[model samples]
Target: MAADVRLSSLKEWDDDQVLSAMSEGNRLALAELYERYWYVLYRVAFQKTKSSEMAEELVQDLFVQLWQKRASLTVRRVDSYLFGALKYSVIDSIKSRIVHEKFQEYQQFFAPQVDSSTEDQLAYSDLLGTIETELLKLPPKTQEVFRMSRFEGQTIPEISQKLALTDKAVEYHLSKALKLLRTQLRDYSFVWLLISFGQL
Candidate 1:
């Protein structure tokens, strides 16, 4: 009877407990983790994307990625992992937007009507260039993953298959790569958002 009670008690926990379970490949644990970090990630996404739908998408994507890689996952600290993930995810998203905007600009240049306003466009272009340079500074494999996910918009599974890696390995690489980007682009939310989107 005492053992039963203890087991029941062990089933219930806050963020840290859920994370511990998640590390052990428990779906319920991952769900609990999603509940704990969703709002925080959403806020970060919102700050960067400035679009509720996009922010929601970003959070949703992050959780989905987490779930997909639950097996063979381990974390020393849940808070750091969650926040670091959010930071990287946000940066990836922002960088993707920058890339998309540049593509749009390219298309517009070839189109009939180009925007008359050049100053803001130039500023944004320069900012994007800076962001790209930072991305290039990442390790080659990390850069490849980031580009495949952010630029090519490949799914995690696709990336894993293409790279001949396990799903967990892919997740770890992404998480680690994002951590590096988070540290490098800590001050720039826009840059962070771009990368975060790519991260997922």
Candidate 2:
């Protein structure tokens, strides 16, 4: 039992040591620290989002953001800092949903002034609907890759492990899938390009 306790303590020190190196701007250390917590962060976000799909994305995005800002990040406790970021990211997602709802309501209020050109509006809406349908029609693995990279914000290596694919394979699949989507939706609007930046 004492040995077990000692082992646990040593495991904790391992995490802290990696974190110390990370704070000193070690990319490899940061990657190790993130991999250690990736699943935990995913679970926390998944619990909040109540969707395995969205949770995966949230975890990915948080780590990407963390990596991008690692040089400036300082934390007294790595676990607490990660969970705090997860909470904030989830809250931000909820707020976005609320804002979207409000915007939809506002649009409904002004429905009378909507463009009366049914042909054009229908065509545009149909195109959007078609794109969404096609996206959903993709293989489950492809969808997961898209969600992890674009929405959750994970790196290629991370996604590769999560889905049990090689990093090179992940990159190829993502590239091909993204190319198809962009080509199909390119004529719609450039705003979808921005959606690739963060979660909706």
Candidate number of the best TM-score: 1
Q: Give lDDT tens digits, candidate 1, residues 1-200.
A: 86455345555786667766666766666666776778988897898889999899878877877776677557677777767877766775676566666545544553333564677567656656765787787777877877776556555665776898876877776787787777766766655765575344
- Candidate 2: stretches off by over 4 Å: 1-13, 113-200
TM-score per model over all chains: 0.52, 0.47
Overall lDDT per candidate, in order of appearance: 0.69, 0.67
What shift in Å separates residue 21 of candidate 1 from its native position after superposition? 2.1
* lDDT of model 1 at position 105: 56
Q: Candidate 2, residues 1-200: lDDT per residue as tens digits?
A: 86455435444567668766666666666667766898888888887888888788778777776776667877778889889988877876665454455445534543344656777567656765765776787777887887666555565655765788887888776776676686677665443453333332
